[model samples]
Target: MPVSYIQGFDPQTLREIVDVRHCRERLDELGDQRSLPALLERVWLLKVTGDLDAALAVSEQSVRVARMGGPRKDLLRARVLHATVLQFRGAYAAAVQELTTCGEEAEGQGWAALAAFAYQHRGKVFYDAGDFVNARADFKRALFLRQEAGAPEPELQSTLAAIDAAERRRADVSVAG
Candidate 1:
């Protein structure tokens, strides 16, 4: 997430807002269950609604829950999502650290889909940092993984678009200078 992304997230309608109101209600109702999906959804909505700190908190809790005998993929997914929250908050170093671990773990486990997902987010973090070269490389890897897994084309298209956008931006900067 970048400054432009935050500016363009001007949600005008209730549905568009993606607030954590309903998520909170669901959490309360499922207190004992601690539904991972619901918790992750709550974190995502909170971040979308501009509550970065709160989202981070829930994300941390999600990781903790995941570490407590949760599935490896769940833990990896939670950590990846948490890194996204960090990215939104401009904590690039932390986000990179988290994403790197998640990506490595996903790859080590041979989780092509999860590895692709991790790479996509990691690429976004690199893009946000203006490290276009690394970003493009990560996106390319993500695209390859998606293709190997037979994932939808939209995701592959998104990775390619990110690479193209970064290349264009870098080129523009070079010519301007």
Candidate 2:
């Protein structure tokens, strides 16, 4: 499910369908105390609501569940989403770590689109931190992967422009020095 859709789903509907309490009850009923998807959903909700600490707590839980389940795909998604949350909170170094792990996992899983998205997000984090060199490198990688995956052009174009601008600024600074 798309993150937007998941986030936009009515809380009432969630209560009826996949409430955390209900999920916990179901887990108890099933004698399996791990509800990875539900936990991830909660974390995403917390993130969208700008509750970083709550989001981080749930994200950590989701990572543990994904690890125990040995589902690389879910693990990659969780890590990438967690990294995005961290980036939004201005935790750049931690975001970089999560994104690097996500990239490695995506590469291992042969998920090109996911890898590209991770790179794009990591680049944005670097860009926000004023680390234009690393930002340009990451954005370049994202552009390559996105192009290879036949992604929409407009998105890549904007990022490419940003990278170009950053590089030009760096060049200007070097010349001025």
Candidate 3:
């Protein structure tokens, strides 16, 4: 996962335009490792590099690996990450549906952190779709869940930033209208 926070995402796009060089560097460092963790990282790297097709393929492989060998929680996490790739590809409806299910399952299993992740990414999808109202609501839910999970300060800060971004965009739309 990228620990470096993305600053100054364009309000219009509601997504950080990742530097392909950085993602490529990470991919190079990842090498040919086929471990589940490596596969997941590759999925993220490919997604950020704007290789949505490759990302989706690797994401499917990740989910299959997790489902076959990992725990249920790991499977859910993989599914969330897969949904994020779908979100980035502009498959908004499919991404939202998958994320909604993941969020519900995580919450039902008392996994607040996982639930937060699901909700936060779903909020990003909503933001990308220009649905600021739903984005803000999901971001707020993610913030609460992160706090409940005792997430690290950086994680909490990320959610806070998301909420602020959504609010800013919402206000912009209202003013322009």
Candidate 4:
């Protein structure tokens, strides 16, 4: 398959839908050190399939590639993905810091949707840290940005639902107290 045709699909989504042979074939066709999204997806595929070392290497390369300069939003996306990879490594604080910087940079760049992406991840990290309040706050910020950008909401809805559930949990705790 032509690399362009293969690139038309997200590798992560493609991996789920296709066999390992075809997926690996596509990855081989696409080659390593490709575009930001492809690198992110490759890293994600490795991460999902229990290839942490490869994922980490791809993620680090993705970060470097993003930093080397392309679109600001793409850089933000790579940074966010790198932060996510960090989370898998048990570097939660570093992940959050990277996410926070990405969010702020995206906000400054006027990339609302990218900022939302950063917020969503930051919220997940905060949740893992047992900081429900901060988690909800970050999720809300992400939700608001996604809405403002007129982005689709299937994923955002889940985040909002999570925030609502967190609020309910806090209220229940208060009542119990």
Candidate 5:
């Protein structure tokens, strides 16, 4: 895993988007010799900074590494992260496709938490695409699964709020129509 703190950076700065292209290029040059954790970290940082293109590149590379190393957990994570990057880039359908695949894989592996995360991200993509009904359902499923998986309280609360907001928006649309 990437260190939560980097030198010369405060806690908040740890997530600051820097030049991830350089890091990605270096990792690519190193090929299979590169560290998985480091690559994941760079991918995370790039995604956080809204550099979707670079993040996608790193995420795809991470998938390859995970497949080679036979780390199913890491592979699922990379797929979900890549989907999230696509969502942020406004590629809702593509993001949904990616998340759907991740969800299937997670379910197959009996990883409820990962599956829940995939559903949650996919729900957000639906919301972005204005598919409020599907979004609400997916978010609710995510909330249920996340709760059963004993995920953090903050995440649960946030998902709940999102569901509520989406529902309210949908209701308003119904009334207006």
Candidate 6:
């Protein structure tokens, strides 16, 4: 038998989901390793599993490690992931602030993929805060950046879905008001 796995944020719930088996396998493989890559993966697994506190700690460590010696791109990516953990923890302001800087730096560096990632996550943060306008704007920007970067189909689809969701919510809120 062949097994398949899919992991990402649910469009409706805005909650991240991971293949448990895959997550377990990866975690086991990473056991006790504190390397930057290992720490980043652990942070993602922990965050997806709702272990926000543990994820936050690991993400912070990953950022520190990335800052200490990792390449510039790695440091920016680490910061973006850390900001995501913060977003999940309801630290919207902090998440948005970090993501803004990450997006700017990525764009300045001509890293379209990284800039898209930062914008997409920032959109999620805005959505969680009920700022649908900003969310949709960010999502649209992410979509454009992703396209420019030649991102894979799934990534482009994800951004499109986010944009749709934000647009729908914004329309609903306006109608209700």
Please list the Cα RMSD from the true structure of every candidate, rounded to 1 decimal place. 5.7, 8.7, 1.9, 6.2, 6.1, 2.9
lDDT of 1 at 132: 73
Q: Per-candidate TM vs. native?
A: 0.81, 0.65, 0.91, 0.76, 0.76, 0.92
Residue range 91-172, candidate 4, lDDT tens digits: 8899999999999999998889889889988877776665668877998998899898887766566667757755665575
Alpha-carbon runs more than 4 Å astray in model 6: 1-8
TM value for model 6: 0.92
Candidate 6 per-residue lDDT, tens place, 1-177, comes to 011334566876566666877776777888879888888888888777678999999999999999999899999989999999999999999999999999999999999999999999999999999999999999999999999999989889888889999999999899999
Q: Residues 122-149, candidate 1, lDDT per residue (tens digit)? A: 8888878878778778888988988988
Highest-lDDT candidate: 3
Query: Model 5 — which ten-residue stretch has the worst lDDT?
Result: 6-15
Work out how many backbone clashes candidate 6 has.
0
Error (Å) of candidate 2 at residue 135 is: 1.1
The lDDT of each candidate is 0.76, 0.70, 0.89, 0.73, 0.74, 0.88
Candidate 1 vs candidate 4, TM-score winner: 1
> Which lDDT value does model 2 have at 27?
32
* Candidate 5 Cα errors over 4 Å, as ranges: 1-33
The alpha-carbon lDDT assigned to residue 93 of candidate 3 equals 99
Best by TM-score: 6
lDDT (C-alpha) at residue 1 in model 4: 13
Better of 1 and 3 by TM-score: 3
Candidates ranked, most accurate by TM-score first = 6, 3, 1, 5, 4, 2
In candidate 5, how many Å is residue 96 off?
0.7
lDDT by residue (1-177, candidate 5, tens digit) is: 233322222221112334446545644554544577767776766676566787788888877887788578888887787777787788888999989999888878878888988998888788878788988898898898898899888678767876886787789789999
